[model samples]
Target: MIITAVLPALSKEASIGNIVLSEIAEYKDDKQISHPYNEVKGAVLNLHQFNGHNIGVIIPAYNEENLIGETINGIPEYVKRIYVIDDCSTDSTPEIVKRLTDPRIVSVRHEKNQGVGAAIISGYKLALEDNIDIAVVMAGDNQMDPKQLPKLLEPIVEGRADFTKGNRIIRGYWKGMSKWRLSGNFLLTWLNKIASGYWNISDPQNGYVAISVSSLRKFNLDSLYGGFAFENDMMIKSNILGIRMMNVPIPARYGKEKSKIRYNRFIIHTSWFLLISFLYRISNKYLFRFHPIGIFYFTGFILIIFGIVLLLFWPVLILGLVSFTFGIALEMKEINKSQLRGL
Candidate 1:
């Protein structure tokens, strides 16, 4: 496969080297399997010097001066290019990138500081322009494991899915993540399931991801949310576009990397974002795509709204709550039925 890894790096000076080198080791382990494929009793299914595939790494940096150089140096020699996007950093991020002498490194700068979503978009556009077949995303903080790239790419390369993402909450892995972050991610995942209709996906906030070029082009890049909600926003878009998606069980990795997110602000903004996006999806799917079942979501929403508004009137409140609950149950049943039929 023509593979490209996109790293949305920030101020990762302390940990970037270890993460990058880990990717090299992962690539070496992959190269040892001569056939690279096997037949299972029930089923089936990157970057070092052993393989013939062209590889690229895109690192979008913002004020990542201390770690950007180490990050770039750690890419395996087999990688064909590394695209570094500087998003108007007030620090020396650009100069650090410019000082790198590796022929594989290519730098792009944003005139202003956009969010991580925008930085990834910039990297994605470059990967597309470079004609890469598969584009993978890795956060600059080094929280994502480099060894798991193979797992993320298997479904896409095998034509089983168009998009694949990491699921940090799977198989009891949440025990390692911070309690506050874990709770927030779970809540966001629940909300995302309702809005995006991807009941199967978890860890909605995990940024480790991969997408086929064909599937990536199907989205309107300009319209994607440019904040922390960007990953969730992409899930909603995937639902709207009918992209086949799956999640890989990956463990959470947290260290000295300081988070730039403010939970209070994030909660308010992301709530509004999802609410508006959900409404837009309802309108688009029902009115435009012609999915008749959209009425279920609307009915449930309206009843819930009425129930909250009539809280002072005990009789109306009780009646409204019952009806709202029933509406949600019916909707959920329908969704389950659709899944059973393989819709």
Candidate 2:
């Protein structure tokens, strides 16, 4: 039952405090509280001591000198160790981490600047080397609330799931989230649901997550996407491995941390990434593999395209339309049948 938390930060000195021991809204009634820490601490204390569960925390920092200490200090005492990965920050992020008095803190520095995903992958490698049982991902900018972590960890600990993530869309909590982000989240989530074959999860963009070490080892870390699309890339890989993923309801917290994302670029870049990943997923899941549904899905897509191109030929257009409709019907039927089978 050993658990480790991983935090990825990038130039977030202003916003990291918003996440540490942050106020969490009660799922039942939306009542804000500051003591998810107490509840989680108590739960850990009550676990069977003989089970030997140890919790380790990891932080990936890149030029986050202003708020790294606050982020590290805010972690609950129940954790066994904190790994801070300094991804070649131009600032004094590594120096700041070294000055921390907590003996559990371990700093790993990268010689060059890699993206956040690479930093996280590096930390994952370290966690695996040390044989950490379960690794949790938290952000260095403090967007992830530690109080709700138990919800994410419970399924993995109980052997019900290999990976778990936070879902901020439940209960219509999107009111506080930025409208642009809300739209992007919805689009990406829908695409991810189809691509990953994990229909139960929403808010696929949510970074707060916990994954079993065994599952992490199954991935080729070097091949994963390195930018903001990294999380979405992980989901696709997880689906390929047939690992179970569960989503826990968690509220979104926005604060002083200025987002590095540019809306136009994010949408354009991520949309392309998702579209390509979706095609790759379909190919791997159906065409490359022996799955009946994949045949119908792709046939339907191809027919639709052909139908548009052959509009001048009335007979061919009619035939393509009919074929496309039938293909879509079969694909839908198989999707429903698969869901029932899972149940």
Candidate 3:
């Protein structure tokens, strides 16, 4: 198979040079089948030119003492710098990160525990100040395989996407991930699809990702949430900016590394955060940031409001919920949740 050949080359180095679309046939995503691959091939060709580019990888750690070394060790030599942000760990995670002697690796310790989002933002800011062409995120727990790092960068390097991430929801890859994590990621990813205009994107929760500097400045990182919501929320922000975001399917490797995420917390947190992020992105992009076909949205909104006021004041008016439903249905159609979820 085409991927069988390309996988070996890609795994060895971040650059899979001279790869043709035909060669990547085995990795051809069915979701993308309708889009054709000439675009992807062109992007791949462009990706080859980014060798020797300045790159920074952000490894955010909490209590990941058992796995931090593997993450630091597997980083490709070509990366310009590695930053480990220790979010006030109760364990030896910060000490372990400080022990890494790679000249390119820098360790930053927060005085108190900040959320994953804060750590990532801090890392990205440092990377940006360093003037790196690309900024990558690979968690300290070592769930991300270094082999797929190049693939995540390919789309960004090729100008196909300003941001790209690892998508573990290949259905086949679900086996390697815990059922709880997998299910939660699926829900959040689906919600993200509805919130952001980017559709058919898989695995929004996979933190293994790369972003172009252009994409970084477009977001006000300080305003985003500080935990798991960060990833999904960032995608929504990117979509609002008309920045292209895509995913490369990657196999997940979850081991004994303790998951900082708890299901009950995630459920309560993700629900509230998703609603807030969706509304913020929708308001900014459709209402305040940029204007598209929002004349209809406002008209529909006003109609629903008027209908509600009329219905409240007069029992003769029965069209309140109907009008409100019309606006909501149109909004949902515009966002296209089902399409984005790859249904």
Q: After superposition, how far is residue 147 of candidate 3 from its true place, in Å?
A: 0.8
Where's the lowest-lDDT run of ten residues in candidate 1? 36-45
Give residue 121's lDDT in candidate 3 (0 to 100): 87
Q: Give the distance in Å from residue 48's predicted Cα in candidate 3 to where it truly belongs.
A: 14
Output the worst ten-in-a-row residue range by lDDT, candidate 3: 1-10
Our tally of clashes for model 2 stands at: 2
What is the TM-score of each predicted model, taking all chains together?
A: 0.75, 0.76, 0.72
TM-score of 1: 0.75
Model 1: per-residue lDDT, tens digit, 69-134? 766666556555566767778888776666655544546677778888888887777667663567
- Please list all clashing residue pairs in model 1, or write none if there are none: 9-140, 13-67
Show pairs that collide, candidate 2: 5-58, 19-142
Ranking by lDDT: 3, 2, 1
Report how far off residue 339 is in candidate 2 (Å): 9.4
Cα-based RMSD of the predictions, in order? 10.4, 10.8, 13.5
TM-score, candidate 2, is 0.76
